[model samples]
Target: MGKTLDNVYKHQSLVYKYFLYVVSVALIVFFFPKGGKFKYEFQKGKPWQYENLYAPIDFSIHKTQQEVEEEQSTIRTNKTDYYTYSSTVVSEVRAEVSNGINTLFQTEIFTSSQRESLRNLSEEVLTDVYDHGIFQNMPQSRGTVVVKNNEAQPIAPNDYQNVELAKKAVTEYLSDANSYGTDRLSGIIRNNLKANLFYDNVLTESALNDELSKISYTRGEVDQGKLIISKGEIVENEDFKVLSSLRDEYESELWMGSNYYFILLGYTILVALVLIMLFLFLKRYRSDIFLNNNKVTFIFFNILLMVVATTLMVKHYENFVYMVPLCILPLVLKNFFDARLGLFVHVLTVLILGFVVPNSFEYIFLQIIAGIVTILTASELYKRANLFISVGQITLIYIVGYFAFHAIHEGNLDNIEWVLFGVFVLNGLLTLFAQPLIYMFEKIFGLVSDVSLLELSDTNSKLLKELSDKAPGTFHHSLQVANLAEAAANEIGANAMLVRVGALYHDIGKMENPTYFTENQITNVNPHDDLPPKESAKIIIDHVIKGIEIARKNNVPDRVIDFIRTHHGTTLVYYFFKKQQELDKDADPANFKYPGPVPFSKETAILMMSDAVEAASKSLKNPTYGIIDAFVEKIVKGQMQADQFLNANITLKEIEMVKKVLKQKLTNIYHLRVEYPE
Candidate 1:
């Protein structure tokens, strides 16, 4: 069993790739709904393209989403209140009367007879206030139903009054008893009164929710075999509602039917077919990503992740599905790969989501257009402003697409759902965070994005800075090679940024023994001259190994490190080997060659040629334009004869273009331009 798994783990094999393709497709297909799909499509205010439609079963005509939401908001605003009557209000009134009488007797503000009359007036008025019920504000329209001893009594809207009004009644009762003490008596009575008719939140919420749930979701019913709409007839708002209800009823009935499992199987197969197309596309065109398990998994993971997010939002927060930031997928993929692959994956994801979301056509249409805009405007994403601009364009596309669809449906822009437009704007803002997401994926999946490459190419970066201070000459050589390679890569339609960054850090190993290499040696004493040929060749070859170590230690991406490993392309250090050969006829040449796997990509091949041509161009004495052109040809031609570029995915035509760029660049550097007369 272990051996069997070992064979499966070999990612480069055809069997391994096929296994991953099946597994990835299977996992994505599992997220699809088990309910059956409708055979025909319909939209509001559009002509019915299919034949006359009829309902096969009796189903309720559900209200539109907008109508249901509006009803819910109204219910929440005017919900009935459930009140628990506390006999505590009577006790509170008695306490207020007792405290008032005690204070009056202690202060002696009133004579004995007047205090006695005040106490009698206060008791009668307090009893009347408790009976009328001192409440907080006025009662709601549906009325507050007070519960006591399992009996519920409804209080009228006008029956409940504020505590101040209750105190005024007490003051009126006392005005005749003591003409001077009416206002003072009211103040003492009002301070002790507390509204005991407290709002019962638990019971109130339960009652409100019960009322909301009782609100019928469906207003009418359609009988079986009823003709819904005729062919070529425009679907009005009423007809659209009936059709949507029928769709929901059909799906719900199918879920409980005996053929439900078969429907699930069909959905699984459909999703799998879409995923299979993507797999074949990668296998045929993007085999570099296909051959690596991590990269292929990353792509499928992103697609599945986006689908899951869309599915959850559609199932729950249906109105806010547009705010899920679907465009972020294409923007991130485009930054890592190309626009074509990004758009392709995004289209597939949106299609899969279309199977589950409402108004499938509009959702798919808006997302695909936004994805295209994302790919077009998100180039050079290392610049923060480019992402911002791209997000703006994507949001604009979403808004325009939504408005156009709305105009078709309603025949006017009156009562547009402007909140959805705000959702698209929020989506655009969320997409700007894809840079950090890209960095996270790079860490988790061991992938490198263009943003990382751009940062690595900066001369002020830590590793580049160290290289400059330790080995200035090698750093200068690297910069020239970067310039030459970048131009050549652009000419050949290769990844210019990747090759430029790779060229900048290709010889970082030379920092370990800076003065041994002639480029970094500034002193008269030559270190290599004192050592034997084999020993000196070992020192030269060790830079490649040491450079790999340094790069890995500093967390350099492996893609850039490939240039360091393959720049020499199994070529011999001829200067030292020839010196040994002159001393002894049988000196082994293998000891002087750099260990290499050869270049496997156009960018790496361009680097190899540029590195060779730029280093050799320094040897030209009193160089002319023709001489520099020939010098570029000789070094590249020798490398071609050695078949150094055979393994790289580079064509002879592209190699010719690289040579043209190199000759022109070297001429500018060495051969002077004709001075124009003033």
Candidate 2:
């Protein structure tokens, strides 16, 4: 069973999902209708009895090597006696039977006299009823039913594949048995029945023909037939589907149970906890592939979405029902992270949830395609209207799926059209409304989501107003940063709106001490003009750290706080660093630098580099496009080499792309004036 599971899977931990297998089997046992006429219901001696799965091997009956060697020696010694050639050996295992000719012998409980009588009757009937053919002289017993000289013999199920022997056995058994019993046996045989009708007919070959000819015959067309399912076959085939339905219907009820579902659920929780421990110990376990300024809230939302997805799949069935949500997560999570990471998670979830239901192929196929489609459609997240695009894609996908299913699904239309349309609507609502759902969830639960940008843009946001009132310059500077960042982010297909909103609120810390930073102060009499350079640097760098505290206390979104903390990184306060150095030749370069750590994300790095370059470009007294270009390049590279480019998803190539685009925009913003009158 374990080896069979390995063949069907790709990942290892998912082997843990066998818990579902156990739970399913247990449910079958618990829900066994005690008073019903069910078969294969864990009852002893039933073909599909549950005990078969865990039953211990019958090692007690195993033969010793010495016994096996003796058996092999007998087979070699008997080869010439049984075969046309001595070189051939037969591995045909045999069991002692009550007789040779009765294919379905009366069981061992039969009297010895009856067994002998049956054997003798079979030979007597065969001699008078059949003719031997020259081409194939006799049947060899490789188990199953075998015939020699038109007489049938029974063999065990273990060797039934010998077709030549099986055919003669069937022919001989059917010959006289058609009328063997008093006319009482003329009706169809019961499914779970034992019979020797064919064995009885061995001598009367013409009676075999007469029995078959008794049925009506039709000529021109192929005959269609209904397969008669036995009670045992029905119960075995009914299992997995029944178990799947039970899972969807009673998930919460079963999960809360003390034992049956707890084994699987508890193990899942343990795996998660172990992964958490591994995360802390390995440190690198999280694999920094697509982190951004909104790392925590982004991760929180993704994990939240992951759990929601798992629950939905567990609770629902149908190709589109559970499948749609499972596919939506990677796209949703990647809105703040990146599409690549979203695709990765989507693939992982598809493989896991693929097995949650019985017919996994259909659900998994739809899920993986829908997930990739959603990721492409929702590639960038920082917007309000992108939801519409997702909705559109979802609707289109559902339509395509509708047609595919319409042609292939085996069902009556009376039940399917409305359900299919509802699925279409449901998928659209989830995909399009995810952004709003995130917003509402964050607001209600006091959580943070990447969608928090919608709230960050509020001009009446207390921090923005405070910056505007206490330090209009800083407020205006933030607006300019918003414009610049938004434009740069858009040009390269990043989350432009998030960049704008983040830029707007990035300087909220300055509101705590507006005069300490230059952007917040207007008068030429700078605050740093009076203070020592190192002290000024502390106040300047402190805004980022302080902004984080202020944002947290005010219930600002955690994503916004992350932006504030990381935007500056540890890039040096060059002006203060230079002055402190001039004042003391031996002063360490780190003394006047912005307190430790560097920008950890593409969004923050862009903000840090752009915020510095934009402000510095504006102060260039008489800036040229070339000079602006150089300045943007210089600051970006400075931040880049400081290894400040850590968690950001921007490739070096993307940074260069960001640099080229920012230079063009800054050049226009800081355009030189013309002396038209002269």
Candidate 3:
């Protein structure tokens, strides 16, 4: 029942933490970007056709006719200058309308009622103007005017426009608009201009030109020479929607622009999410304290590395983007996180960053392949130590990765020899240099990685050395725990290294009283021998607590202290309580017990069981392997039934595995000596 309540309390304690974790991780997932490489997409057409064609080839030299003639002539133009060959352009405009309804009329440009009025006026204007079309002109003799130098200029039938003809043409068009209101005179002028521009009569063209020149000073008419409409220039309407003209609207542009933005944004999210997920998974499997902190730190470090690498790759030299995501990510992640996460994140990073890298899926696939192979090659890299081998290892991953990439992406491998040579140089030279530069990013981020583990075993480390001097008894207990926990962790497929490291300091609290604990005793005069067993048990129980206080002063981690306090639960002090029951029959059951909160964690519970089993197994004079096996199971089952192993989340299956492992370990630890004496 007590064990049940401890379990309940332990669960209650995790509720808030679980809530925080879920909410934070949910935020991450909500914002988690999905990763991808780009498919073959039509980016866009070149800015302009002439510019596009010119950019690809050099066709700038301007050749002359003489140069063209000097070359082998395919066709003859002129051998002799019999009549100086030249070109002449003549546009004969006439006011003639056979025709059709106005197609250029935009209803929005002109209102509905106004559109009807403009149509009626246009018809009336066309008819009246066509009726009184050509200007009445008297034909003059066509003769050649000869000068002193024999310059002969021809004199035509109609020399130029006269005042009478101009008045006649203007008067006739004004008569067309007499019936209608002053609706669209400019529009009328435009219609007349279009007719004249397209008409084939020279006499009618002369009249239209004469009428326009007569009103040249007036703002009502506009004449910019030969044609009213320029041949190639673009014209647009009011709403900027290019109704009947040729200009690309901004709407289509914005649509394509947004798609590009979404793709880049999505890719960024993907890189970040993959790294975060990898970090989270590793943290859960490792020891909770380090797992949580180490992963969080590494995640931030990864984001920083990616952002910086992206910025530099894009800013300084654009070609290296393909290299950074695949090569840099794996190298840096290995330097900052463990090799496992580095491998997975490297794959994801390569795939995602491919989108922003301006490469197709086929091109980026090689990057992913190379990075994964590189990380696999460097899996055993110990960066803080083994600098020489580590560099070689990184170089190998880089080289192997690069070649694999080159091979995978190289659709045409006609250059296999060259590719192989490049791979060798890349692995042997480039990676050696690149890996070190990438390592700097990991250091800058303050992320301690697996290589940083060596510092933990340092004798000068505050917690380890403090355990040795101040709390030698707890320290001894911790060593026993390290062995037991690591063996159990290994059996369960947990992080044995993490378990051992944590276990080494689990009893950091007991150092408060070096002489109080049994393990630290030099002489075998049990301290309880002088006192009532009840008082003795209280003193023994107090050591678990005293260990906590000492551990606290020394700044031992909470995970370590948890083992110290929870190792011995609130189980009754059986020896003391049973003794009091006989001597002082009325002594309260609770009063004789040591205050124990049952084991509430796997490490602590394992320690408690192992600590008892290890001591108990030493009692037999001839402790054999079979005896150790039976004793191991007995101690484990005893602890379980006593309810001391309840709240730790340690499964019975795991406990059974622990029993089996303990038997094997204790056999070697307490191996029986052969009876050699005769």
Candidate 4:
């Protein structure tokens, strides 16, 4: 087991790990909602282009979403809602009223005989009111009174009220007595009587739910093998109902039986095919990325992340799928790599989602167009305004594609879902965050981007500022190298921003011992004259190492640090080395060479040549175009013979282009042409 674990860590196991990765991704995608796709695509108001359709199995016609919702609303409107009547409340209130009447009669305002008569009159009237069945006031003047043991009795709403009804009853009862005493008796009843009946919320809700459960959701059914619809039949309301039901029953039949495994297997194979195609493309063309596990993982991670996001949206938030920022994946990938890879991954992701999202054709079509727009427009992420413009274009494409598909499906735009357009706008706004996401990717993956390169190229940054303040001559030389390298990079379709930034910070180590280098020596009294030739050579070689350390300390990107390490390309300090050989013919040559893994990229290679040519141009006494041309050729040829650029992925033709660009730029700097008479 330990040996197996060790083998897994070895570089030779990369292929196995990649296989495991692909399998894991395929399995995850398989677990998502890969609903069984209908054999033919159909839309409302469009003709059925397939052969005559017949029911394959016995199934009931199902309702559309709108129909189901409307049926539910109608049932809720007509459903009998129950309310519980508390018998104990009526009895308790009757006793309280009797006691209140007795207490009122105890006052001196009533004599013994009068008190006795008043009690009799109140009791008789209250009894008549209680027999009427007090109930809660309800809308439409009606309510179902739920009694004990779940017996529901309907009653009028006016039954439950204050003592005014009781008082009226008492007034008629007292007609036989004197009218003068009846007025005084009604005042006493009004002051003491209060409402007793209330609605029981818990029982009402339970009973209402019970009634709702009894309502049948499936209204009607169709026999097995019934003819549902024929080919080329316009899907009117009734036809849509039959088709919607057929789809539901078909999906249900597949899910409940063993047939779904086949569907799942098909989904897995399809997703795996797309992923494998992507891997093959990368391995064949972008082999550098293919070999690096981290880069390959980064690309796959983004694709998987977007897939998971889309699947979740489709499953739970089908309506808000438009609100997802699907364009972000292509935007970020294009900024990091190229437009082709970005669009490729985006297409694969949307295709996987097509199986799950409702209206798969519309979803896939809109996202594909948006992804294309993102790739075409979102290139320079360093410019903040570029992302805004790109996002706007992506949003516009989404809107146009969505409406066009809607128009095709509906045969008109009058019923278009305008809310989805708002969602698309929100998606575009979210896409604007891709710039910050690129920064995060750069940090987490240790990858550099154009945005970071642009920030580094600024002259006021800490590292560049220090180089300028402490070693002004090296700083000026770096500026010239930047211009020369940028021009050359543009000529060869290289990363101009990266090459320019690299040229700017290439000689930062000279600030540590600025005077030791010839460019920074402002005095005739040279510091190197006081030291041995080997020691001087050591100082020159040490700058590359010191520059790396300083750059790391200051948080420079690894790509920028490449220029610092490879600008000299392991070449010997010829002046100091020759001087050392004169003193001791056996002096070690290794001590004079810069510690370098030579320029491994075109940009770094360009920086090396540009740095050499620009610094050499400074030493010419009688400068002319011919002198500049010869100087450029001599420096570039010498470096080529030393094989400095062999590992840098630069071709001979590209090197010649760089040479030509350097000569032109240096001649312009020196004003080598004949001066016009003033």
Candidate 5:
């Protein structure tokens, strides 16, 4: 039991790494649609690239979506409108008319005979209006409509009199009967008349749906072992429809019953292989990131996020698949890491996504190209215009690549999908969000980005400004170091922005006691002269500790604070240590050394070289090209011999490159140009 627990504790980090890998693969595969992938790739109007395909089993050829929709639309447009004749409404209106006339005649302005004549005339008008049928409202169809009473009958548009027409007929009939009060009788008839025809919505809808249901989704059938298409044959309209139908049938039948588990197993293997490739890449080239579980988690989390988003988009909004901002993956990664890793991860992500998206080749091609553009152009993310320009370039690449694919597929520009161009534009706009996303990721993951480094590098920032005010000499020294380190980093393809930021804040602890440091001692009196050698060494060594405390108090990222701890590495303060050794032969050397964890990255390593070279060059008198070159080489070689860079992931070749850059920069600083031979 003791041995088992020991083994578990010893390999816990390895266990956690594998746990992340397993979970990422599971989540990605879980979101994938449970359908078998069709092995062949094809496009409308493009020639078949594979061998001749044959139907392995009997399947029907389905109609295209356009054909199906057109047929349904034709049915709806020509569907017959239905109207119902309500005899009950006619009966009630006629009875009301009779009662209204009798009540009006009771006013006694008319004789018995005059009353009789008005009642007969009113009856005749009502009969005429009712015989022609007063419809409830006009039908939508202008053609003849089917009217249902006890049975159905087709009625012409002219056969029916709506309420308006019925009222007009009543008015014209009583035009010559003014002596019998034409206005009074007309009002009574118009008020009593009601439309007896009403539209039958239920019957019309049923009939239309019945016609639509009769539409044949499948137009033809392919027998078993029949040739579908030959290689090099252009997939015309009919061939496209047939091929699409076969693909659907093939996938549906392939991923059913016991075959489902096998298909799932196949998917798991493919997904695992892709993720394993990513793991291998990080392990091989970026072992620093791989060993740090938090960085590994951050990378895996981004990959999973992109996969889930694309899976949901493809499942729900397949038509707008191009609208997804896939290029943001490389953009964000490039800002946080480097271009090579970003593009590598982007390509891997796109390859995995190819399993879920339709037209896998085209999607993979477009996304990989856009990702390459993203890595190449998305430099200097702290500058808002750079991101904007990068996003624009990415958008242009997407549009151009898609246009080329479309031209290949359709053999013309005439049928290019203009809406996808708008989708590409929208994708570009969403990519602009990568800047804010980087900020959020920094806060959540405790990682730093170039944008944050840019913010920290600002000379007007609170901590930097305090450093400038309290120790102007140290602040100027930091600035010079920043320029030197930045140039060296750029020369060796390291993170220049990171090295610059580190250099600017490396010596902020000198602000704690400005007078003790030689750079800030403006007057002739040296503060160190009065102090004991041991005490002076303590003060110089305490600056690194003081700088870390100040940075933590000011909420500086730990990545930047690493510079303060590692700039002098484990090297001793030679001036104070030598002074102490001369007074007593038994002085301890521990008191004079800067507490260090050593530089662990190329950026931090570059800062160490730059900080040391820039400070020592101040003591040189009458500097020249040859002298500066030798001086820089001696200082770097001494540090190298002391193993200051033993922990750093830098090559000897890179160290030499940094030395070259520092030498050239120093010569320029002192205005020491080479002399021409006469």
Candidate 6:
């Protein structure tokens, strides 16, 4: 049991890596829609590429979205308007007219015969107006109106009388009376006549909705085993509708039964394969990241974030899928790592998403192209303009690619969705968030980016300024080394920014004992003259340690701190060791060496070479071109013999390149003019 526990502890890192792979795969698969994919691919106005397809099951032919919208629009335009007829209003108006006529007659305004004639004419006018059904608010246009009384009845637009029409009818009836009180009688009838019909908004909307609900989404049905379309046949309007319906039905019903587990298994295997590809890529091209569990987790976390975001958008708002800023993945990765790894990871992520997004071919193509553009155009993210330009280029590509696909599908640019271009632009704007995201990742992961490197490389920074004030000679040495290392890094395709920053901070430990070092000695007095050889050696070795402490206190990232740790790389402090050996025959050599883990990357290794060569070149009395070249060669050769770069992932060819850069730079610095032959 003890041995078994020991084995588990020994392989804990491996076990953790496998656990990450499993968890990432499981989470991604869980978010995927649990529907079976359609077995065939077809596009409207394009030839069917697959074999002839037949309906596997009996299914109703569903209408296209455009077709359904047109039907609904037609229904809305021609729907019947409903109005309610008020019987109580008619009775009240009739009684009021009769009462008014009686009151007028009691005043002796009319003779008995005139009073009788007025009452008869008023009653006749009231009956005629009520029969026509005066409307409280008439319809704006002539159309069929359903009037609900005891039972709902359809009425023509002319059948309903408005107030003006009823008043005209009353006036005409009075004119026919030819009585003394015709005008007064007419006024009584017209004033008492109130509109009995009113528009019924609630009933109208309800009836309209009923009609809309009755709209048939399915036009016809296709029977099982019926040939839907032949191979190489152009998918026209009718064929496209039938094919779409079958695809929908097949996917929806395919996973409803015992086939669900199979579908889930299929999804799991595909997700696992894609993740495995990403793992293999890191292991093959970026082994440094693959070995560190934290870095590995960082990469996987980014992938999962994109997948979750895209899946949620698809599930809730499928039409807005283009709005997601997928290119941000490549942008962030390229800033943190390199362009190659960024594009690789981006492609793998898009491939996984292709399984879920609509138009698998189009989605994968657009995303891959955008990833390429990000890699090609986005550089120096510390500059704000570069990010904006890159995002604009990516958005433009999206618009152009989608336009091309749309034109291909529809055979014209007439039906292109202009709103989708806005979505693409929004996508570009969202991609601008990658810069802040990179800063946040650096903090969370304890990693440094080019932006951070650029910030640290500033000589006017607090730590560098203190180094300048306390140890001006060492600060100058650091600046020279920074220049040399940056030039060499650029020549060999290494991280020039990182190496430059590392070179600037590598000698910060010298600030602790500024006068003890030769470079800081501005006076004739030498501090080393008062100290023992062993103590001088100890002080020299302590700088690397002191630099680390100061950097951490200043909240420097671990990546930069690595430079201070391994710049000396376990090499012997030869001057003090030789002096102590002359004094004592048997002196301890272990105390004279700088404790180091050695440079383990190209950038750090370049710093080590540049730091040693640049400091040693200052001792030349009368420098010449050949002398300076040989001197640079000797220093680099000595360091190589000491195996100071044993752990660094640098090649012999790259070392030769660095030597050439250093040689040219030293000759330039010393002004070693070539001799002219007269």
Q: Write the per-residue lDDT of candidate 2 for residues 1-678, one digit (tens) a residue.
A: 988777667543334334433443343223221111111222112243332222111111223334455655554443221111111111010111212223344332445665555444444433222222111223233322334434454444343323244335434554555434312111111111221122223333443344435432211221123221234432332333332222333343444446454445544544344334323432343444212212433443454455445545445543445435454576555654567656765665555443344345656676677777877777445565776777677677767765666445433333355666777777676666576655665665555445567667877878788779987877888888887787777767777766777788788778878877766666777767888988888888888787788788877766566668777777788888888888898878786666645655566667776787777775676776667767787877777778787767678777877788787777677665543655
lDDT scores in order: 0.85, 0.54, 0.51, 0.78, 0.89, 0.89
In candidate 3, which residue ranges exceed 4 Å CA deviation?
Answer: 1-301, 322-348, 360-394, 404-453, 458-481, 524-526, 529-538, 569-574, 577-606, 642-654, 673-678
Candidate 5 per-residue lDDT, tens place, 1-678, comes to: 999989989999999998999999899999997789888888888899999998989999998777899999988887887777777887898789889887887764888887788888877887777764777776767554556456667777677678888888889889967756667888998998899877888988988889899999998889999999999999987888888899899899989999999988998999999999999999999998889899899999999999999999999998798888988888888878889999999999999999989889899998998898888888888888998999899999988998888887777898677899899999999988897899899999999998788889899999989999999999999999999999999999998888999999999999999999989989999988899999998999999999999999998999899999999999989998999989988888888887898888898999999999999999999998889989999999998998999889999999999999999999989998777879
Q: Once model 3 is optimally superposed onto the true structure by TM-score, how far is the C-alpha of residue 65 displaced, in angstroms?
A: 37
How many clashes (backbone N, Cα, C below 3 Å) per candidate?
0, 7, 9, 1, 0, 0
Instruction: Decide which is better by lDDT, 1 or 2.
Output: 1
Best by TM-score: 6
* Tens-place lDDT digits, model 4, residues 160-201: 444456556556766666633456565555455444445676
Runs of candidate 2 with Cα error greater than 4 angstroms are: 1-286, 289-331, 356-358, 379-389, 392-396, 409-420, 423-436, 440-450, 640-643, 646-649, 672-678
For model 1, the superposed segments whose C-alpha errors exceed 4 Å read 1-16, 73-137, 140-210, 512-515, 523-538, 576-592, 675-678
Runs in model 6 with CA error above 4 Å?
A: 86-108, 123-127, 130-147, 159-177, 188-199
lDDT of 1 by residue, 1-678 (tens): 988887767634678567766776676666665567776799889999999999999999999777899999999888778766667776876787678778867876677777766677667767777664666655665657777656777777767767777767666766756555656667778778766666778998998889889888889889999999999999998988898889888888887867788777777788888888888889898888777778777888898788888777876788898889998899878878888999999998888888888789999888888888788888888888888888888888988898899999999998898888788888888888798999999999877888889889999999999999999999999999999999999988889999999999999999999999888988889998899988998999999999999999999989899999999989999999998998888998888899997898999999999999988887888887768778888898988897898888899999999999998898788756754669
Question: Candidates' TM-scores?
Answer: 0.85, 0.53, 0.50, 0.86, 0.91, 0.94
Q: Specify the poorest-scoring 10-residue window by lDDT in model 4.
A: 133-142
Candidates 1 and 6 compared by lDDT, better number: 6
Q: Candidate 6's residue-wise lDDT over 382-430, tens digit each?
A: 9999999999999999999998998888888886778898899999999
By TM-score, the better pick of 2 and 6 is 6
Runs of candidate 5 with Cα error greater than 4 angstroms are: 80-92, 103-137, 143-154, 169-188, 196-214, 586-591, 651-653, 671-678
TM-score for model 6? 0.94
